[model samples]
Target: MTDKNIIWHKVLDDKKELPEGRVKTVTAAHKGICLTHYKGKFSALDNRCPHQGGPLGEGSIENGLLRCPWHGWDFDPCTGHPPGGYDDGIDTFPIKEENDAIFVGLEPEKPHETTVSDIMVETMINWDVTKVFGMVGHSNLGFADAMRRQEEKGNLNFYGIRHEGAAAFAASAYGKLTGKPAACFSIAGPGATNLYTGLWDAKVDRAPILAITGQVKTQVVGTGNFQEVDLVQGFNTVAEFNQRIQRDSRHAELMSLAIKHAILKRDVSHLTLPDEIQELKASSRAKAKTSKNRITPLTIAPPKEAVDEAVKLIKKAKRPVIIMGHGARNHKKEVVKFAERLNAAVLTTFKGKGLISDDHPLGGGVLGRSGTPIASWFMNECDLLIVFGASFSNHTGITPKKPIIQVDFDPLALSKFHQVEVAVWGEISRTLEIFQEEIKGETSAINPRNEIAARWKIWKEEKTKRLSETSDKGISSIAIFEAMNKVTPENAVMCVDVGNNAYSFGRYFEPKNQDFLMSGYLGSIGFALPAAIGAWAAVGNSRPVIAVAGDGGVCQYLAEITTLVNYNMPVKLIIINNNELGKISKEQRAGEFEVWKTALSNPNFAEFAESCGAWGKRVEHQEDLEQAMKELYDQSKPSVLEIIADVNLI
Candidate 1:
């Protein structure tokens, strides 16, 4: 028998300096570990989530129970047992508090033999998943079960999104964040089809994503059972690896191949797992498939002659501009260096808004309705545009009348959806590096255009005047968002839903570092609250996450507020309390059609938020907006601030 040897683990200060009931986390043995003080006693557990190694420390805690952030796996802190039949429990260390300091005794080995659940829990303490995102559906339920099993085991974190599209978007977004391949999941049928939007977006944008989906039961294939849809057929449009797991065969090999294809192709890969097969036990010796990251291949240097040609092109041109997109986000340091070498003014699309800091000397925010005046000015004035990882779309209102030098890994993206004068096919950072070297040797200053600068100033003044006038009049959606932005922290994230709300924001709020995650391009409305939960789960309470939804959108997914309140995530939801499907209503009215069909009566949003145990407030007038915001921010809990504004504003 071994005597307990105490090893001190200092948590928060003893003076109640940190707020009571707030969970704090510490990293020990390079593992994210959670510690909390309750009822004058200290408790400690592995911070890594048991299910997928999500940061359990970041998960919400209420009473004496802790829930996993990745999934809502609830557990009692004292016993370390997850609620219900789920036999998962975390390793609890004995703790002692003495002289205002905390100490714990960690056992080198468990008193009992390790099981599969134990492996799942322990692995999350050290291992981390590259990326995980996807929609939740029936066939994928088994995968979700696998994820839950991993969570019980505690080794990694998987982030969930609203739809298959949102999942792919999140994976691509995370890839941009980490410069590595991200993992995504989806279900069969419609779920598979919805994935194309994000997968194609990833393809055009040149992002790496690993996508998984649930297929129909092998026996049901052609028989057309419930949810039995052709996943391979649906996924053919966007996925580089569209694989349906074989029946009664080597399933692990296929999963491994799917994972490998995603990494190697630098594109989206889709793997469809049948319902029963996904639940079947894998061989005990099964190992994760591995592959070299495709971004590693930068060996194809630009020929010196090609570099010289690029330099000459730059030197001879006036009003030259560089458009940085998600590609530049991956090779941030290299892109910055390249931009510095040319002294070119930079513009980014909404998706690439923060590829460089908004405060950077050259960045012009984004280019479109939400674009700064400078970006718009340069876009019209520049005769030579150096495009990198940017797609000129209707969203940007971009039309190429001048010579545009396109640089991208996706050959198809070289065009303005089929309009390009000069195309250079290669990796963005590598190509930019070659162009940068050439620019250094060239003599001309690539002089800034005075006309462009003058035009930008005038546009800025006009925009300022318009904003001021708009703010003073009947409450507009823009005014509401601007006010919200002013009160929230600089890093506060805002997740918006599709419909009139998304376009309203896209045309209104200025871009910030806080990611604007949405299901807009697909026009999915019941996405706001859940996606916000996922985003908060990803970033934690280090900052606030706000979900802006319309009355219709909120009504569709209001049940998720229970999840938010229960999780104790400090999220502030703002409902544009216009009691109608504003966009469709307006469209119908414009087309001289009946409006009642598009109109809807909604429940009291403030009451709904309160019902779920969160601070809820209603604001009818502009005068009450700031006060309502202040109250929500000060409450230090998940809350809903419903702002009743004119329906026409949307």
Candidate 2:
């Protein structure tokens, strides 16, 4: 019988231990089966209920009949028959007891069939979205299985995170770094809503990301079912393209469109998958979509008149300055060439830090609130401002009074706050290339390289003076950053959270060849650790990834340290523990308001890191900071260095 048709698989060790007149759920040949022991005999039946698809094993043996817990549906436990003579009944598998074990007989397994999740995942892969950061739950089991199949086939990589928020932030950072869409997955209700903050970060920063959230079964959607929420309405504002997956909807096409909108609009796109719809059988003729002629080139040149006017302004100005922002990240080479041709100083906004090396002769460092004195001096002295891809936020403080020539791919960003001399709507690289060509013979612009060097010298002297003003109570922010600047690798990827630590980093840490990521517009705390995880995923272990956060920021996602330990990620986390919300206190003082509710009671974070299975160290004095940093960076595993910092020294 085993060779001809029936395949007998051992399911339970012994039928005698199952007790009399009881039902238990077991798996045999990857199928859920309900094994019942009634009247001193063993029987097997499908575990799923006919109504509402509840588990029959969870039901009790009432009046010698199996009862489903969902709606109290009753059926005969031994013969798989209903008690009310209803037409609906479950199929039964042949069972036998021998050799102290129970074996269930089943037909030979058939070849796998494609599911709706398979089609959607295939479409996502076709669009080059292969990184998924999320959690698996009861509602999304089928989708998770589809993802598992793809991961087994080497088609994608899935990371199960500790929290849904971390998943969204990881996907956000991945999108920001690669300029491609990474997916975040979650269940319905709370799991879906937990993704809002990170999705808002992606939306505001113009990074592309895809959010896949699971929903309850379609039948119970409007009946206030468990774990059900109106996801489509919840994500309406944050997502540029939002849709729900339905049994009759085009599954592959919906996924393709989501990816398209994410990439083309550079914004969040969300999809809701009903629990039952995810497991629906796919059509044999369905095919995944690709990027074959579906996307257009984004390299647009500036208008001829605008370019001519910009050239005229460039020729007339004696002192010119170039301001770059996050949007100009990919076009740094062209921007540098333009700056070199004009012999002008190059300043970056806080979000645009590390675009131009601070060591460059023309580099004036970051501008605005968390900026250096060198950048502000150059901006104040310049006669004409040439801005590229900058939003002109108040934090950036780009002077509107200066004669400006602004260029951006989005027309709405040009002169967004106020009017400028020239508003050139074009792609950043193409516009810079045009400027380089148009200013070939114009050598009248002053060379500010010498002045830039002098200004940097003055700022360094001031920083040195501040670093010496240390307190016996705790380490100063300047001292911590000074040690970091000396020990941090040149090629490291740095993620900074929002706080006084971030401010000090922007002011003191001179980036060589590093890439800096931050919350930028959102200014959300607790962003560093999760962003560091995403950065490590993007670059792997080839380069070091560091996260800089204040004590208040690190405490928000403290459990994620265990996640790093679980993956053995080589991330060096530097926490400036001031035991207070230092940035808020400074802001309160600046606004003439009493600093209240800003102080925090904290724990020994280094000890916590060690408890989480990562290398941990604490630094109290300025003299020990460098050595602690060295020890932490030398480790081949995840590590943390917590410095007791002075709250008043920032």
Candidate 3:
């Protein structure tokens, strides 16, 4: 079995298992071997048919000849020779029987040569982009195998997902948290097309991500082959850099450039690999490229004049509020420091829910539609708006009429919606540093902490009143969030789906040091579970990952719960089963249309999770919510806690 050239493989099918005149396909050292038994003797032949790639083992032996399942080509069963000794024939391997056990002899597999896929994958690894979520298929087998080798070498982590869409969402979430690129892989046609929604999410949210797709063979260009689509053109609208990997392409440099674009631009970069080009041998002297000096530090400070004007405007205002967005995720310390020094109230956009702790004195919750009254009151009362890294999306409702100072790293994002008093173009952390240095003395701003506390008290009283309300239809969202507030770890990372549940969470769930991720601009449903998978990859168990979704949202990627179980990722998921698309229904009524086709017929998700080897529980009432959530988190595995709530309550 350990010989150098003729390595023996144990077929595991003993002599009794093979009847006379029968054949069965078995794998030997990763090669398929068709074992045939005829005339009280056994012989091993190659499993594949030479003509149409059919499984010869699945064919039957009739009239002393084996026939191919596809085209019925006949060959001598004993020697694997075609009728009349044709040049085309199947190869035969030596077989032996010892003590009624079967074994086949085959030459050891040839060492893999350096191919284009191998070089590209290695370059991606060298750039420290390790996480890949995707589905592997026929067109992408070469690239998948390359990744497999890299994974075996401990250089990459590839998660094979049930759906390409989930892979994209997971990669997007990883980029949002780490400010780096994670890859989503797919095959040609439908597989590649499925990634569009999640890729758009990354693009609009300014999260860096890489999308790798497979294309038809280059020889079939514009010939309309099966499952073929122009992936480069398809991906152009969603990707910052989109290209097709062709033969003789600059392999390693291409990968480096893709990674560079994703990270530096904070956008989606895509690459399409043709079927045949993926396996082409690379040049002998080719080497993987790295990100050693390609990226420079993003510490650009705003112009001195812009900073002076911003500080001057701050000094003249009585009440100044700081609005932070997802872009300021990493510079939390400096943003909070500047707010405290100026004695200004701080508000966060919905996507920036946890940028600052809600427990902080000056912290006003989320702004705009999915926001608290506390934030709305502060924004309305503030005379000056000092915005940092926020996009001023209509969802956030940052008033352009007010005197504003918007600081962003992207010059294009400055004054994107309307002109502000000062539009500072600089990196968030460095610009906040300059702001703190300039405003060393006390300003005309009032002690807003007392006012913030007063607003929070008023909101909490209303929330308490909502929480105690009972209904026969189902439990209120306030009560569900109240239970979540009790059990959720302060340091947990939450991935929220778009729905009324999101609105309720923003209004009721007080975020404290927890980082939040969502489909901020695209507002896609079904983002929660897959994004949690991504979050788990980023922070692992160091910070618990929680996904929040409504019934409609969870159903989109309901199968992904098994992905958590497969990877042993302990992601706690909360499903608010309201029995309908509550948000859409609300919108329909608001538009003065008859509500139709929004209701959902749901399953017992708790039992479904148990079937998938995960801990699960469903709570139908407020009294059982706390116990169910506690039990869900107690287990050291992926778990689901489904809460049945009233649709109208949210």
| lDDT at residue 415 of model 1 (Cα atoms) | 75
Most TM-score-accurate candidate:
3
How many pairs in model 3 have backbone atoms within 3 A of each other, for residues 3 or more apart or on separate chains, i.e. clashes? 0
Compared with the true structure, what per-residue lDDT tens digits does model 1 show for residues 570-642?
8888888777788888778889988877667888889988988998998877767777888887778889998
| Candidate 1 local Cα displacement, residue 30, angstroms | 34
Cα RMSD to the true fold for all candidates: 12.7, 2.5, 1.8
Q: Which has the higher TM-score value, candidate number 1 or candidate number 2? A: 2
lDDT of each: 0.65, 0.90, 0.91
Highest lDDT scorer: 3
User: Residue by residue across 1-650, what tens digits does model 2's lDDT show?
Assistant: 45469889898897776899899988899989998989988889999998777888888898888889889988889998997788899889999888889999989898879999999998899899998988899888888889999999999988888898988888888888778999999999999999999999889988999999999999899898888899999999999999999998989989999999999899999999999988898988887778778899999999999999999999888899999999888888889888888888999999899999999999999999899999998999999999988899988999987899999988988888899999999998888778878877675788888898899899999998998898877999889888888989999999999988998889888888889889989989999998888888888899999999999998888888988998888999999998899989988999999999999999899999999999999999898899999998999999999999998898
Clashes of each: 20, 0, 0
**lDDT of the structure predicted as candidate 1:** 0.65
Sort order, TM-score high to low: 3, 2, 1
- How high is each candidate's TM-score? 0.69, 0.94, 0.97
Q: Model 1 off-target regions past 4 Å?
A: 1-145, 158-217, 247-249, 263-267, 279-285, 291-306, 332-337, 356-359, 369-373, 441-460, 467-474, 518-530, 552-556, 583-597, 630-636, 648-650
